[model samples]
Target: MTSSAGFTASLGRRRAYWQAGVCLAVLLGAVYLARSHWPALESGAGRLAVADQGWLLTGAVAAAGTWAASALAQQGAVVRRLPGARLTATQFAASAANHLLPAGLGAGAVNLRFLMRCGLPPGRAAGALAVKAASGAVVRLALLALLAPVCPGLLRLPRVSPLVVAAVLTAAGLAAVLLATPWWTRCRRALAAVLADIRALHARPARAAALWGGSVAFAALHALVLIAVTRAVGLPLAPLQVALLYLAASSAAALLPTPGGLGSLDAALAFALTAAGTPGAGAASAVLGYRLLTVWLPLLPGLLVLAVLVRRKAL
Candidate 1:
């Protein structure tokens, strides 16, 4: 009887190992294929070679500042003071993870875990994230509206084709189905909690100020980084125009539910720069340089920080 039981256990272990190997192989294959097929990944490196190093360095510094800005906004969303160092590390990790998981789930999950660890109830923690996101979105739009007038022709969007409209409607329909079916009850509860939290947060003047101010600074800094990259790539567009184009492009990219807005954001940014009077090569170089600073360069370090934070039980 003991021998028979041992044999069964060994077989089960083998099967599990085989399954894990198969899954890993599939994932790697998909990634490899994607890199080969995607023009952004293919051409970005080529453009980076010719990009001006000094402007790129400046953009990198600006990119690094974004995590700090995000941390500030997050801290301001709640009344409890979070540990500054840990909070910044968490934001960096979240940004790295955002590229791995789809539809912003990576960052959301990280922040949710961090907030719960900070002693908030699950609902309240989720509410805090909601408040932060809503505040950021509102501030971004406000900035766009404010800057559009100053940028003059930067706000002009190209004519949308019929295919684009259909694609949008299809995406909306899918989202509606998912909301209506799978998690409606939980979503309703979460929304209610978030609304309550938002009201309470707004009632606190200091927290409100921090939240709104940090959000505005975050958006502005991101635009500034892109503007720096554009200049580095020899794109001659005005600073205000670059900032406005960055805002508009980023807002459009947010609609696509990809991880970290990867391919969609790259394409949108390149198109926006080109439409704003930059040469195609220059626009491509600018987008690549900006992403190199913000995403590719920091990714490894961010992951290392994430692992350390996890080991230390900070998140």
Candidate 2:
């Protein structure tokens, strides 16, 4: 009887694994079909035949660098030392997982599990994630402020129409309502804990430096990839200008809660490039090249790593 029960439990676990694999396959298939029919993506794929291969390769290399930077930032968030190889691999896996879940949920879930496994309490693990996110946002804004003066007219916001004003007001109202809820106090307490964690983590100069430096490098690497893509497609924008545009467009797209910023980010990037005077076809090509390097190329390998880590119980 005991042996039969154990066999049945093992069979159930295998069935669950099969179900997850099928779901992931379905999701990837749907994304591929959607991209195939998207006109901009179609044009960009065609332009790839004529693009400079060297520049595209450079962009791909830069994409890889972002994963290392992310791992560094995550390590810096906590006082406990994490295994370097596993942490980096987790970041690589997280990048692929981000596409599978919405609003950063996939990566966040993976990292949270990692932190818990590292022996951090659940609340502290969450606080560490918050600190990393907050620090990253600050670094991006600081970079934008520094670059705006150098890249004049490159980060222009669109003229605010009545609809924009209404949207802003409605958002503000919603935020106020949210804050008035009973849950707001809990949120405030969570924020306070996160702030305390940040203070403690930053007390060590090395930790502070790693956190800030890794964040800046991570954002910069992303911009560099975009710049490389632009050059590959023969767009004439300066590097600083392209970087600034990337920051602005990415910030704007973060407002949307999509998985991996898929649709919103791509559209915002294409718009920003065109606004900065790149031809429409070139902008489309650039976005395509950038996505190809950052998303499509690493996706399969990242997922494979994710599967390995899961099977090993590393995440």
Candidate achieving the largest TM-score: 2
State in Å the error of residue 117, model 2.
0.8
Once superposed on the true structure, which residue ranges of model 1 sit more than 4 Å away at CA? 1-47, 160-186
lDDT of 1 by residue, 1-315 (tens): 999889879978996566445445545654664465467545655766877889888888889899999998998888788888989999999999998865677899999999999998887887889889999889879888999988776767679999999999999999889787736776788788888877887889888888988898889889989988887767788888988888888888776656687766777787787787776667767877888888998999999999998999988
Tens digits of per-residue lDDT for model 2, 145-235: 9999998877777789999899999999999998999668979999999988888987988888889989999999999999999888888
| Residue-pair clashes per candidate | 0, 0
lDDT, candidates in the order shown: 0.82, 0.86
Q: Provide the TM-score for each candidate, comma-separated.
A: 0.80, 0.86
**Where does model 2 exceed 4 Å of error?**
1-41
- The C-alpha local distance difference test score for the whole of candidate 2 amounts to 0.86
Candidate 1 Cα RMSD (Å): 7.7
Tell me the TM-score of model 2: 0.86
* Model 2: lowest-lDDT 10 consecutive positions: 18-27
Give the TM-score comparing model 1 with the true structure, all chains together. Answer: 0.80
